[model samples]
Each structure stands twice: as structure tokens, then as C-alpha cells.
Target: MNTLAFDTCFGACSVAVTWATPEGPRGAFRFERLERGHAERLMPLIADAMSEAPFDFSALQRLVVTTGPGTFTGQRVGIAAARALSLATGAPVASLPSLAVMAHTAAHQLKGETAGKTLAAAVDARRGEIYVQFFSGPDLAALDEPLLTTPEDAARRLAGRDVVAVGSGSQLLADGARAKGLSISVRLATLEPDVRFVPEAAIPTDFGVPRPLYLRPPDAKPQDGASLARVS
Candidate 1:
């Protein structure tokens, strides 16, 4: 199957066009790291990724996207693009969690003895907190609900565990754990979710239609006084 997958749920905007063949899975992708401008870059990145292997949008059978515990603007930009592309191409959009994507990426990158270790994925949520989750293994079967928490608090909860932490919050979480005399390892300085794995992540699960997965309420609130009157 030819699939178009993309993620704009964090500091990076990434897109990939992948095919599942008898030989194995193969694909190409574009990844750009930036704190802003995801809206401008995501679509073009997707097009570029597809064109790399001469895959057309019409050839896409599925659209996989990261539904996020990420930046508000980034999350909205990704889901909207996925939904619109699905409608235009008649491809089913599969929504996967960004945190899980990170976990899997970390797991795949782990070497030797670390390969089977427990994983902790965390994204910097800003304001001194992170979007954190624990997984039994790389498949990211959740050991707990994704939580918005301080690094210290997260470390406390996951203390005494041998965990390979990934994502932007990895360093902070690792440091916190070490300070608390717990065992934790940092896999990378940052491991933003990869769109290349979005398809794999979706295929094995009941991936529903793409939707924004903001773990907490948005910082922006509605203006009740400016609201239109209710029709009913």
C-alpha cells in the first residue's frame, strides 16, 4: 500500500511517502526543525516526499497523521492538512498519538542491551512541564495515560526504573531522575516523532479519523461576550 504520512505536532514538521511491498517497507521523507511556520512547510514537505519516489497523491491509499500532545498551532495545522488531503484523495486518514510515535522511534534506535528496556516518551509542554507517557516497550502500549507534568514529578513517579527517555524533554527528565537517585537514560538530545513510522503505528491499531489530541485545555479561551446568540 502507498501511504502518505506526516506529523506537525512538535518542533519539527515531517512527511513521508511509504510503500509496503513483498520485499519490505521503503519510503522517503522530509523533516524540518523549527518552532514556527509548520503551516507553511508541512504541505510542501509532503509533496516533496511523495515526488522523491514518484508517488502521487492519488496513489495514496491511506493518510497517517500525528494527533498530538504538542504545540497548539502545530497540532491544528497537521490535522487540518490530513483531513483535507483525505477528502481530496479519497484516502482514509489514520490518527496516531505523537507520544507513541516518539516512543517507537526511540525504541527502534536503541542498540544491543537497551533494545528491550522500558521507554518513557516526553515532549516539552513549556511552562516547566512536559507531555509524558510510559510504555512497556517500543510498540508503545501505554503503561499510563499521557500526563502533563513537571520533570521532577515525572521522575518521581517513574523512579527506580530503567527507562530510555526520548523527545525534547528527555534531558530534563533524565536529569531529574538522576537527581532523585533513579535510573534513566537519555537516548537523544531530542527525538521528534517521525512521519515515516506513522503508517506502521496506525496499521496495528484502531486508528480513527484524524483529530487534535491536546492533552490539556487550550491556553486561548473563547470570548463569551462576542459569541453569536444560540439559534435554539
Candidate 2:
């Protein structure tokens, strides 16, 4: 399949494009951690990735983007780009979770260490909370949907089992797990969604037009006149 995938679900923006050839699969991608400016960076990154392989957008057979339990801005940025590209090229868009991409990347990169332990994808959701999801057993089947909660709650959700966790929130989860006498190993402590595995991660999830996977309501709320006057 001639597929293109990208992620802007957390602290970074990344894009990947790949196509099948008689020789083998060929692809290219761009990844950077800017923590913000995902809207400005996403399109250019996609263009740069596709240009490396020199393929036309019209040739894309599939499109993928990470819909997230991430920053409100970041999730929208990636989805908007995927929607525009899909509209232009008629390629179907597959929405995958950013944490799943992180987990999938970790599974491939740290196969040895992750062998028997449960895999936990933990993104720092800020405000003393984290976005977490668990995967267990050989197939790495997801044990639950992505969740937004405190690190302590997430650690407790692991049921005191040995776990290998990845992402920026891993340390927090690790600390909480230790407090409860459970074993947790942290890997990729500053990780964002690994764009290389964005497409691979979709294989385990349902596909559809991308939508923001806000695990909780946005922090910013409309201020009423009295509140606005107080701030002023």
C-alpha cells in the first residue's frame, strides 16, 4: 500500500510516507520535538517527507493520523492535515492513538526488555495527571482504552504487576508503582508518538475520519462576565 502517516499528538510533529516496490518498501519521514507550533510545522513536515520519496499526494492509497489524549491543539493539527490530504487525494484516513504508536515503537525497539512484562504507554498529560493505556500478553493486545488519570491511579490500574512503561509520564508512573511495591521499568522517558510506527499502530484499532480523542474536557473554559472582570 502507498501509505502516509503523521502524528502531532504531544510535544512533537512527525510524518512518514511509504510505498511498495518490487525491490522492497521505500519510505521517508521527518520528526522533531518543538512542544508547540504543531499547526505550523505539520504540513511542511508532511511535504518534506513525501518529497523525499518524490511521490505525489494523488498517489496515496491510505492516510493515517494520531487522534489523541494529548494537547488540545496538537490533536487537531494532525487531524486537520490528514483530513485535507484525504479530501484532496481520496485516500481513506485511519485514526490511531498516539500512545499506541509510542507503545508499538517501544515494542519493536525494546523487544527483549518488554518480553514478559505488561506494556504501558504513558504520556504526561500535565497538571499532575497522565494519559495511560495498557497492553498485555504476547500479541500486545490492549487491556483497556486510553485513559486520562493521575499517575497513582494508573499504577493502581496495573494491578501490581511488573510493567515496562514508555513515554514522558513513565517516571511518574514508576514512582507511583514503587510506592505500592510494584515493579515498573521506564523506557523512552521523554517520548512522543514515534511517527515511524503510526501506520503500524493503526492495525490494532478501528479506522475512520479523524476526530480529537479528548479524554477529558479542555482546561480552558469560557469565563463569564464577572470572572472576566475579576481578571481584568
Candidate 3:
């Protein structure tokens, strides 16, 4: 079986193609950090990754994508790409949350370094907010629910705790966490949604409705005088 996994929920866009082998599985990955223009770059990156792997889409048994509470545009692009690829190839599709992916990366990295320490995965939500989640040890037990809140607020909420803060939000919230006396080991650039930590599952044959994990509503709303149409 062959599988393709991708994540664009963060600053970097990544894709991997894996093929089951008698020895286990072999895969190839491509990643690029795009400050902007994720939509323009993702497809070409996917094409390059696929080309390097030399695998045909029709031969793929599964397609996996990271659904997110990251950038709204990035999340939409990733999920839409996965769904479209699955439909075109008749492959099963599976979705994993962006926070979970970050946690996975952290857990994998902290295997022997922090014997009993807890880890926190966070992403910049912009507008003075962060998308955050907590985990314990390598197993990555969930310590709290995923949320979007101000850096100061999150620091206060998780104060007086020793945590290995991982992800971009760590940098964004570093000052607040320090001021709050939180025992935080800032490891911002270390954690990323890479292939090694991605969880695997049997892709569902049914492609149900794909949903975005938006912590809050969009910033823009239609004007009162703007035309609105209901397809249904």
C-alpha cells in the first residue's frame, strides 16, 4: 500500500509519500517554509514530492492531511487538496488535527531529554492570540483542551508549571510566560509537522464532509447591503 501525507497548517508546507515494503515502509518528504503564498506554492511542492517518489496517484491507497486551527487559508488549502487528490485517485482520506501533529513532534523529540516533563504545543493565531494544547511525556497525554487565547492569558492559565513549550507560539508567548513565572523551556523552532511523527491509520473509504478546526469565526462578515445567495 502507498500513502501520501501533508501538512500546511503551520508556516512550513510539507508532504510525504510512503510505500509499504516487506521490511516496513519507505517514504520521501519535501518541506518549505512559506511566509506567504501557501496556495501558490503547495501544489507545485506536492507535484515535486510525488515526482521524486515516482509514485502514481492511482497507485496510492490513502491520502492524509492535517486539518487545523492554524492559518485559515493554509488549513483550507491543505484539506481541499487532500480531498481533491483522494477523489481523483479513488484513495481513502484521513484527517489529523494540527495541534496533535505538533504534540507528536514534541513527544518524539523529548523521548529521553525530559524524563518526566510535560510539553506544550502552540501555534501563533495572530491578533494577539495563540492556538495551544498540552501533553504529558512521550505518550503525549492531553492536559487541557485546545484553545485560542492571548499569550498572557494562556501563560496565566498554565502558570507555575514546568513545561517544554514547542512551536511558533512559544516565541510569541515567551515574554508573557516568563513574567508569569512559568517554568518554560522555549523550543520554538524545534517542533514542526514532520513525517516521522505523523500517526497512521486505515483511511476511511467514505469521504464525509471535511471541516476546518476554526477556534473562532472569521474576522470579516458580509455587509448588510452585500448580496447573499443560498444554494440550498
lDDT of each: 0.79, 0.83, 0.76
Cα deviation at 218, candidate 3, in Å, is 1.4
Give model 2's clash tally: 0
Residue-wise C-alpha lDDT for candidate 1, range 9-74, written one tens digit per residue: 888988888887688988887888888999999888887888776567887888888888888899
Candidate 2: stretches off by over 4 Å: 198-206, 225-232
Measured on C-alpha atoms, candidate 2 has an lDDT of 0.83
Candidate 2 per-residue C-alpha lDDT over 1-232 given as tens digits, one digit per residue, 9 for 90 to 100: 8888888888888788988889987889788999789998888888888887757988898888888888889888888888898899998988887888888778878867887789999988778998999987766788899999998889998875779989889999999888877778898887777768643434534457889998989778777764554554
Name the better of 1 and 3 by TM-score.
Answer: 1
Leading candidate by lDDT: 2
TM-score of each: 0.88, 0.90, 0.86
lDDT of 3 by residue, 1-232 (tens): 6888888887878888888768877877888877678788888887877886647888888777888877889889988998888789988777777787787766667666545776778887778888988777556667877889988888887776677778888876676787776657887554667654665542334545467888889888999889689799
How high is the lDDT of residue 42 in model 3? 83
Candidate 1: pairs in clash: none
